[model samples]
Target: MSDAMIKVALIGNPNTGKTSLFNHLTGLNQKVGNYPGITVDKKTGICKLSKTQKATILDLPGTYSLNASSADEKITIDTLNDATNEFSPDVAVVVTDVEQLKRNLLVFTQVKDLEIPTLLVINMADRMQSRGISLNIPQLEADLNTKIIVISSKLQTGIDDLKEAIISYTSLSTERCISAGKIENNTITHPELLTSLSAIELKKVQHRETIIRYQFINAALKKSYKIDRSKASDLQAKLDRIFTHKIFGYVIFGVLLLLIFQVIFEWSSVPMEFIDGAFGSLADWTKETLPEGMFTNLLAEGIIAGLGGIVIFIPQIAFLFLFIAILEESGYMSRVVFLMDKIMRRFGLSGKSVVPLISGAACAIPAIMATRNIESWKERLITILVTPFITCSARLPVYAILIALVIPSERVFWIFNWQGITLMALYIIGFAMALLSAYILHKTLKIESKSYFVVEMPKYKVPLFKNVAFTVIEKTKTFVFEAGKIILAISIILWVLASVGVNEKFDNADAIITESVSKNGFNEIQEVSLNNKVIRFKQSLADEASEAGKTITAQEINSAIAEKTPEFRQAVIDDEISALRLENSALGTIGKAIEPAIKPLGYDWKIGIALVSSFAAREVFIGTLATIYSVGSEGDDEEANTIKAKMESEVHASSGKKVFTFASGISLLLFYAFAMQCMSTLAIVKRETNGWKWPMVQLFGMTAIAYVAGLIAYQLLK
Candidate 1:
């Protein structure tokens, strides 16, 4: 390849520590993005070989073969074969762990057959010492006709040797040294089999292909490869006796899930509270420091509040990803898949669907994309359709807030956070719903396709902490940025609608309210005006008391004035004017129109407005409520809290019962949990499915479920 940067690609089977080795070689300089015309990620980084010669290292997605059965494997195969794709690497490094040598060699052999300069990396050499394993490196090198490098990503040893091997990539051979053997010994003896073998050999001879490939493998195995029968551990046999047993496996799996949920809920609380308090204090400080105006209100009450609603959940999300990454990294995830295969297969899903199901706990968008690996169209479609039913991190915020509001904090067993346990229960219910829906879809959908389940069970190793941390940070960053952007935009729009009014809508509220009151001939007018005067007078006195106390006094007076006087009669009418303006805004008009439909759900026109605005995202529900409450307040703590407390206590006019009762909260929570309220998720589904059909199905299906469930919940609880 001239003096231009040599391209090197790392390819291997899944769970082979390919990613870990890439991280060790490239460090934090890697960039991740989707492959061309596909959602499967393409990760690339630069490995500086010397001051003058830097190599571009592309970390291709993990795959088992060149057979191109799935999108991920197709990408690897297509990129490697196409010279114009620019992903064609000059040198290919095939990573294999020492313990899983036979299985690992399958891919290694495939890569060599492609005739690229290849290097075999025997990773986890430290494990070899611990497990009393041995490898005849020189013999393996002769057998494979490729240079070999031994390394341990976890212990950070042999990395320099690996680097040296990469730097000297020109010395590696492109010759294949092995051939796939006949299926049975009888086949080798058959005349037809001999004829087929001769034909294949004749073609290879004509093409000048390496005949030594088969000869070398046979000779090398005779000299080098040996199984240490006495040293082999029985850990797998012992663990499998219990873990994969028909009865115990299912029980252990269920119990493991229960413990994970309990731990996720309990462990995330401390950091969540700290984040909540920090954001609250920041909002309070911003309001106090900034001059009183729309900008100040927007910053303190809209953007910061909305962003906080998302950020506070990061700890919980990070913890969930941490556990998941560890499970995946240590190869325990495949065991779960193996254990669940029979049950999943009965529901028309392959064992591979287990990965997507587990990933759905974090978000449905990636989970839906992950289904790309499933071989059967029917199983993949069912996975995509039902994954959203699993509780995602987005639903966590809604659950946490509502559960805290309605579920008492009393311990379930003197240890569990009862609120936390309830939240966990909601997640379980979501999972159960997902499986049930998948089963239904499986029975109903009639598409025919081949189905197969094949996965490599890599040697178990202690999860590398750096890998876990990197995953947590990357995933949490994506969650915050994607959800944060949408929530922030919607928050600003809601703030604008609530803050300003058109024409004389803002100017005429006071006059309109006063005229209406006077015409009604209500003797309460005098009493109301007297009360307004007392509240304003007290506010003015408080403002003059100290510099630190002026804002509170003004707020209290404004609240009393808004409450006691009709809008028209109120003097110093900024608060009433803002409320009047909001009532005439576009959002306000929409809310009024939808109010009748939602009245049965225990919401007023004001709450109806908030709900409509929050359809952009669930966390926005909290921000919308905060904005609505802030706008209606007289700007005093006592007035603000009084109004909110009154809101919490007040009954719906149509129902003549408390509006925010436990029933209403639970109904809202259920609706938020199941509904496909995220536009981003829909967009991603559209991208992944390459059509509108699947996203449409997901949208309508989820909304229908949410509606029915919400209706039943509210009716029963009410």
Candidate 2:
């Protein structure tokens, strides 16, 4: 081994346990990013090959072979071919399933021809005997001209041997598995042959090359691979029959979804409430403890409040990813894609589109990137365009807040709450709308292309707990830190906007409120509420005195009440000043400007501000509202300053009705469900489409639909 680190590339076809091996090697060391100039995911991690030698492992996208049929495979080919590529490996580990050794060897041979130091890793060796599979590792090594290691990634066996092989990669053979001249063509095996060929001619050549490679693989496997027909089990087939059944499959998936949503709500409620209250108290304590200053105000009212809106939803987001990870790791998500294929085809999509669409539930950026596997340009474009409408984790924050505020928490049947049912409904609606939009685009778009869908059904296994935990942690962190950055920046900007104003009213708010209160006292509603509070205070004091066996006269009671009444009035005056000041501030001006535009949809100026600010990301809606409501709220009752509490207490300026009424909450939910609010999604769409034309359509076109839908819903409900 050299003093410098080794670069090892992990390559394999989909569902070959490649990810499991990567996780086993890297543990928590891996970081996900994008390829240098592409949207495809680049996962890299460090592995300790030995005490003295560490290797950088790059897990390339899963591809069947290096035929360059799709973007993902193109990436694999491009990396292996270009030595100067940063991620190009010093050694390549070709992972193959023990059961599918022959087919997996196709790519192994392709990598061998690239003249890289390559080795084969036959994964899932633990299942070999049960599946009636056996491998001649020594014979296969000699036949393929590469070192072979058989291991089960799930069982974590033979990993040390694989590490040792990687450490000694310098000794691995660079010989080709099959000679290029052996491709059986009349044309000479010269470099000029490829240069003179057109793309169509090149494709034909590639196809012929694949055929030759498979033939060689078959001959090699005939001597090295064997299967016992009598020992194999039919369990996989039996499960597949039931899981892929048309009616039962849909029912199972639906029931699973319902259960997931129910758990998300019920399991997360306690933590969410705790986080909400904790943040509220922290903000209050910050204001009380820190010397009164603009910095303290920003830290409490702006940053803390804004982040709390998102942080409180961590439990629910984690639960969402937990279920998604389990389904994926258990090999069930593939069955879902298979089951959805018929309906997808009816909507002008193929089963291949289902992965990206379902993945959109996590985030649209990666989901759109997943469209790289869709072979047809038209289908890929449609998947990319409509994917944002599929309710993502970002929308979960918005939906959770609105549903909690508006929907009754009463249980449906005996298990599901109305809130959970509403969340599930929104998800279903999002997916339905995506398919409907795809159907419309299929009829409208003039792009002509032909494509077919092929899905691999991997053998089912119990999901590894370690893998599930890693996924949940990684995905949840991504959501938090990514959204946290946007929220933090916007919160600071919004705080300044809400804190400073050029208007005289904002500057004179304290004096103006004091004088107004002096002249008119409290309003009828305010006075009545204040009097009730005073009565309760006096009665409590009298009861306490009686309990002490001391007589309290009416005059003494009146004197104590008088002292507390002034403090109570002062609180009211300070609160009034805070409200007046915020209403006249810069944010308020902007909000008021847009109020008329949104008012018809049952929103006030504050919600209008939140709506506009949330364009950076959908989850920002909650954070934006949290920041706005927290502005100048220091004088508010400490127990009443939680984001939900503030919103619940809010009333229309003139109408005096609650702001977050049932009608408005539903309208808001519908808007976020359909709106193209995420800038990141738009950027990814632009890059994926290679132009701005489609992304622009998504921005304006989807927003228009959202506006109309919200308008109709609010009107009918209100």
Top TM-score model: 2
**Positional deviation of residue 710's Cα in model 2 after best superposition, in angstroms:** 0.9
User: Candidate 1, TM-score vs. the true structure?
Assistant: 0.62
C-alpha RMSD in Å of predicted model 1 compared with the true structure: 14.1
Question: Compared with the true structure, what per-residue lDDT tens digits does model 2 show for residues 47-72?
Answer: 98787988899999998887666789
TM-score (all chains, Cα) for each model = 0.62, 0.70
Worst 10 residues of 1 by lDDT: 182-191
RMSD of each: 14.1, 12.7
Q: Candidate 2: global Cα-lDDT? A: 0.87
Clashing pairs in 1: 177-213, 510-567, 510-568, 511-568, 555-635, 555-636, 559-634
Off by over 4 Å in 2: 1-233, 524-568, 635-638
Error of 2 at 283 (Å): 0.9
Q: Global CA lDDT of candidate 1, please?
A: 0.70
